[model samples]
Target chain A: MTDIRAKLRGFVLEELVYCEDPDTFSDDEDLLEAGLDSLGIMRLIMFAEREFGITLPDTEIEPDMVRNFNALTGWIESHRQ
Target chain B: MQLLEDFLANLSSHPRSCCLVEGGLRLSYREVAEKAGGVARQLLTLTLPEGYPVAVALPRGIDATCAVLGILASGRCYLPLDLKAPRLRQRWILEDSRAVAVIGHAPWNDLTLPWITIDTISPTPLEPLPLEMENLAAILYTSGSTGTPKGVALSHRAIHAFSDWAKELVSLGPEDRIAAIAPLHFDLSTFDLFSSLSSGASIHFLPEGLTIAPSHLTAWLSDTAITGFYSVPSLLSFWSWKGNLSASPLPDLRFLLFAGETFPTARLRQLAGYLPHTRLYNLYGPTETNVCCHWPVERETLDSDHPIPIGYPACGDRLYIAPRHNELWVQGPTLASGYWQQGQLHPFLNEEGWYQTGDRVGRNDQGEYVYRGRLDRMLKVSGHRVEPAEIEAALLSLPQVIECAVVGIEDWEGIRPAAAVVMQQDEAIPTIRALLKRTLPTYMLPSTIRRLDSLPRLSNGKPDLVSIQAILTR
Candidate 1:
């Protein structure tokens, strides 16, 4: 399985084109204005769902909430409850 | 001629006029016409269904401009799908409109349609725009929250009527180069594109992401030598607050047009002082009816202590207020055929063929309509009739808010009016709330009044209510 950080790093690196390692990018970086499009969140959705065997609801995901590496992962952690 | 016919006729008369511009790039009238013509020839070869909506999915700019003209010239209706909107939005437009084909670039190659990737940046030149005004010109898709995006069908006649009034509204001539601000998907672009072309004037399409920045907007206004600019009040307010237009070189732009929502008197005053003689016009209409009413404002009207009236209906059209300040009804040549997937026409349009604008409006003593707010937005909170527009209007009248939106939410507690506001820089948020208490009833005073950095807007220049809801909930 892909390490979650690697997965996050690769996704951000590929799309945003700049910036560095996923370990450095926190979970709270507002991704909407952070050069990441919603497509970045979409990729994260499929990755999290496939890895955790849980479905992410559209109502739960929005452009404003998923701005950084930490926020996307945090959303997953909170939803697990 | 239908709308396309009028454009084609006008384009033929002035072949050398600058039709599309981006950065240093420019396309003349003859060049655009030839490209659209070639596209028309190619479209004739396709096995398209009659009344088929050809999806033009691209960001607004020079390429999308030509694509729209080409779709009309090809004798097919074009549907502008905002590339910046969510993929679901793009997919929704195609599926709902049942588009037969799409004209896009390589980046959008994966979009589902009988796709034609026409790259204007390549060495290939554009063909002429095809079609008469009698044909379907474009099918514009406007999305409502919680449902599929509905396509508004406009024939050549609708666009013609709109452009005819638009050209007349501004009296645009060859020397009048207007700054094209809104995206292709937005109807506001009608003036800059068709109206400019109709009069052999130039359209300088600003580069993507240039519309928002205050500094960038000021630079474009001066460098492009734009005679006029069209925008919503929010943007105009930003330019005014930044004091970017204070310079002489920064376009004492002849005309400033505001639509989509009411222009606060504060905003109007700031802009009016900057460009003293500039004709400030307040245009009102929904996408369903194009522009049905216009109120040309002088600085004098702004001084009056009344709700700013939206002015009189222009073109072959008229506006009427429903009884008791209910729905606003519009009738005219610019009325769209109906929503593409329309099960029923807009509820406001009764048997008489008037477009029912869900917008609620009241009239001043002069019999001019003062736009109150959307009738559909009324809330039955705690068995009480609550119109957010009322609260917003009162807040705006208080001299603090540049613009604001009042939304109602019913949680476990009770129903309450929650306001999200954008304030003038010198003003404090607490002072606004204090003022609201003095003027408004206790129940009417917003339980939660929050200030936003800036209100988000959809491509159509209206507040992004969905995004706003998210912001408030967060």
Candidate 2:
């Protein structure tokens, strides 16, 4: 689970949040307000699914599920078979 | 409805009919008319000029709709400011438009303009103000190449003509429910708001943040039973790529209208497969000219990988192609009156009354106008029109930035703005980006910024954009 959180943080910092410094981004920071647009969200979902070998349910794709690093890691962990 | 005033007047006959839906809130024609009338009465007390501009800065909801209708009812042109846009850009527009007042929830404390809070206004239905067809209706701002945003000033006549055409083309009726997915500032909302209201159709305003979630958006479309859908091709493409459209077919959707950017043939074909019963149209136009040409997607035309043609003219518009460069020119009632800049109205149409759309096109064997490319360096990033010059200007505003070149970088999603900057110090990149965020919208911001010692220039000392694009990609 810790490894999964690290990977998600790295992907978001490098791809989604372009202007934010990775060192300063808190674990609970709102990704949506940090410029995670629709395109970025779509790409992030795809990346998570591919990286974790788990399918994130489309119906659960709400703001709360991917609001931060902890929420994203938890969502992915629950879906992993 | 021939005039915008007629839309509200005709609503009296269907007083009990549904007019707008946002989330769990639903408004009838009578309720909407009364609220909008209250807004008009508030504006009338101020005694503004006949065609004075009023800025509307509010979230996308029922109140925003009422504010626009109220402004229109007051016989003043409404300038919609996207609340999600950068504050500095919104301020620039408000300053440039010379708005007399802002109809919003809270007072714009920074600006000295009068604010009319919507919730505080009491309902007092008033008759629509008497106005001529030539009176100004709305002013929409777009990215400009000269560093400042250009305001497309449209008259009531232009909107009526386009809405009449749209209403007839889609056969919109009182039973139809249209989705207002586009932002209020975008020209696409013209069809969603004006055409639907004129046709006595109910428009459902998709809540903010729902647009980013494709699955949720698809579910909403199905749950709401939306019959008429209009948006940019990029959004539809994204939904089709990720949303569960195949599993949950929208049987009630009668028409799907897409404009703004070119739709990839493959993605469009996939959409057709998913929504076999729905009609698809490729609408083509700039903000200067509201939907001049469109093509009804044919089953046979999707056989090849090539893009679809822009098809024949609509809205009583005539197309003229420049012989030398094949640039498309439009002349019709739908063309905007002119551009408003720095408190001056500059005529956009030529002496002969032809608006030159900076789009290049060629005639196919079937006489259809095939879209070739843009005649200028404007980049369409996910259906948002971005002028590289605007981004370059924002970069050059910083003191440390000596030179810069902004270009489009194509990736899996689509084209995005990328910049190559030659600055005195590399440490200023973050600060420069932060400053730019205050002036430009998120879509207009450069996706990648790289510092270079110098920009590649041509023999004439102009930046070689081709080389710059190669370097940015490499």
Candidate 3:
């Protein structure tokens, strides 16, 4: 299994924030509050699935996930195999 | 029915005014009529069965709207075919509508329909057709993101009712210059263009793909001095995302109409704090019923639990919700001709003539209906039926929650419901994953709780499901 949690953290930094490192972004940082917009979220979804081969189902695709790295990782960990 | 003709006659009176603006082109009512007349004369020459659809697959602009009017003036129903989408999607629309003729700047791709290019001839002024109230005018194809797009056939009387109803609500006149923001193919823009022109109100067209960027949007709003504008909730929310309403907004902007999606009460409240002086309204309708209902979102209503009320029917419109469900059944003078090609996929309404809107709605004591969500969005869990909207509502009720979506994911055994959420920055993101469990049952808990920086929205400003589906497909 791909480390869904670690992969999600990396996605937040890479696809979402373009952050230099995942450590800088917290699990709670508001994607909207931290300057993430709709366009950015769209790109993230495309990136996360393609990069990690993660098939995000509709129920799992929350609008809020992009708000923070911690939230993204939490979702991955909670649904871990 | 005489309004279109009267507007044509009054075209002579507005000589000095700039009527339509696209790219480098600007046309007065005279110029518009002249160019459109040139097209209409040629279209009138074509020998097609009455009610045969003529599709216009092209970029939206003054030319596109003119093409539509010309097709109708030639006594044929105009079918809008946007060239920007996938060609396959366009082909599906063509197959469904059985269009006989297409007017576009793009090269004719279809093997069957005759393509008519209007720029070939010099301008000739058009004469108004003797149109009846029941005469078929235009059939608009809506983005059936949930299913295949269907054509909504509207009549002259239905069109007239929509225009007059809007005019009554806004009390607009020749003095008001409305800006066209929606793609001509979108149902909301249908009203924006026709309702404004229903009277002699001048229309200002935003440049193609103009509002895609924020800097350009603010500049265009300022440059055009637009008095009124219609947009989707997602678009409006985007403008206010930075919470910059007090910043140099369009000084002349007054009436702001939004439709084609659900508007969360929280976002509306935030908008009120920003644009305190402007009037915001939520117009409701399916493509099938042009805009049958409306609810004016005043600053005061923002305080209610669910402030966005889909108000009373306009003109001869009626709305009745199904018992214990959110689906609203509508019957009105302005209803469309039914899905393209597919005559009767849904007869859920009744012999009395009400069409069921798959959306869920609730009525308050005043008989005002508040939209709940889609009926199908409710999912069946392990021996339990649950509404994702309920969980979403609970999430939003929490101060930390910003926006959310719930979907049901199937596993090896059965199905599980989950939620994706966007949150405010001040809150710890990791904590929320654990926090939501308290508010929801174990089975009801989202299997995954991903956060998004932003949500993908459709052109109509509703959430984009295709983009969402792409994530899962990947």
Candidate 4:
């Protein structure tokens, strides 16, 4: 689980370009408030789906569920095929 | 010619028809007209001089729309300011326009001008004020290179000319329900508001929260049964990339019109494939000209990798291509009154009344006018114009900043403002960003902030743009 969280954090910072530092974001902090817009959210979803072979539906990824790093990871884990 | 007058006539004819849908409220033409009349009556009570600007600093909703119409009904131009915009930017607009009064529900205390509440205004029977077609109707502000917002003053005749041509071209009617995607302050909203209102059609305001949320935006489109829509290319690109448009096909959507920035070909193709039934158009113009040209995107044009042509001039507009570089110059009744700075006609306007559009164009293989790019240093980031100098000036104002220069950095995604600062050695990127957020809008804020010993200088002692670009690119 820790390995998955770290990988997600790295993907979000470097690939998705959410923010400069992975450390800037806490596990439970809201990503949207931390400068992640809808476009960024889309990038996250796409990146997770491509890298982890998950089929994350756009309709299912509510803003509330993707509130933070942990919530995003939780969604990704449950949705992974 | 008289746009406001014609709109009032349309309102009276369709008094009981649904005119505006916003905030869980459906307001009919009668209700809207009465509310606008109340605003007009309250505005008259102020006894401001006719033709003076009345700033409407309200949130986007039915009330804001009524406030603007009321200002027009009272024989004065309305200057709509987005309440969510930075207070500094809003203040600059209020001061620059020299507005007589402000009317809105938003609480702003910085203004010396009198304020009127929109919801509390009492209704009164107002006689039609004799407003001329050539008289000023609205002033929309765009980002300026000099760190100040430049107001584009547009007249009633200009908007009427453009919107009439637009309505006829789209075949808009009372049965159509248009989605208001752009904010009231942006020039694109003019067509969304006037075209629908003039044709006795309904306008459904896309709530502010839904604008950035693509999924929500698509959901709203389905729920509202919006037949017509107008927006910038960036939003459409967002929807194409993320909104899952294929899964949620909008059966009621008839057409989608876009402007303000170049739509990426990949996303355009994606959206086209997703929505095969909807007609698509690329409308092009600066805020000054107000929808002077349009291009209907056909299947062949959509398949190409090249940027779509902006197409020919709309009715009542004359386009001149200068021999020097095929620079686009426009002359028409649709041209804006002038820039609001110093109350004089813009320097871009010639004695012959032709406004030089600063946009350079070239003919594609098919003889269509293809957009080359802007002749100026202005950059469009997500449809909002960002002048690097504006961000640099804000950075320099910070006490810790010694020197700074901003430049546009374009990559695969799009252009973003990047800053190279010669601040105190201890200052960091996050610190500079935090300081800038207080004054600049999020779009205007620089994406990349780098500390530098000093900005690269040319032989002329000016900041070397080429060198800076090389460094930023590297």
Clashing pairs in 4: none
Candidate 1, residues B1-474: lDDT per residue as tens digits? 445555566567876777778888888887777766656656767888776778887777777777777777666788887665546457756877778888878745465467766674232233344456556677776644222355677777887788778788888888888888776777787777788887888888766544334545677677778888677665566556443566543544788787765566866777788788688888877777888888998677777656578878777787777786577888878888777673222333688877787788877788787787665765433222356776787678876688888777554223556778998887765567656644443345565667887889999998887777666655
Pairwise TM-score winner, candidates 2 and 3: 2
For the predicted complex of model 1, DockQ is: 0.02
Candidates sorted by lDDT, best first: 2, 4, 1, 3
Give the winner by TM-score: 2
What lDDT tens digits, residue by residue, belong to model 4 across residues A1-81?
Answer: 676688888765543333434577578876666556554565566667777886766566567766788887887788763
For candidate 1, lDDT tens digit of each residue in A1-81? 235546655655433322334345555666555444322344455556766667655334554445566666666666666
Candidate 2 chain B worst ten-residue window by lDDT:
B1-10
Writing each residue's lDDT as its tens digit, candidate 2 over B42-83 gives 999986644458998877668888888888888888899977
DockQ of each: 0.02, 0.46, 0.04, 0.28
lDDT (Cα, 0-100) at B399 in candidate 4: 89
Query: Candidate 4 deviates by what RMSD?
Result: 2.9
Please say which candidate is ahead in TM-score: 1 or 4.
4
Against the reference, the lDDT scores of all candidates come to 0.67, 0.85, 0.65, 0.79
Of 3 and 4, the candidate ahead on DockQ is 4
Quality of model 1 by C-alpha lDDT: 0.67
Instruction: Pull out the clashing pairs in model 2.
Output: none
Q: With candidate 4 superimposed using the best TM-score fit, by how many Å does residue B96's alpha carbon deviate from the native?
A: 1.7
Highest lDDT model number: 2
1 or 3, which is superior by lDDT? 1
Query: For model 3, how does the per-residue alpha-carbon lDDT over B205-304 read when each residue is reduced to its tens digit?
Result: 7764333344456667777777888877666665554323456666677788888666667767877776666778788876667788888876776787
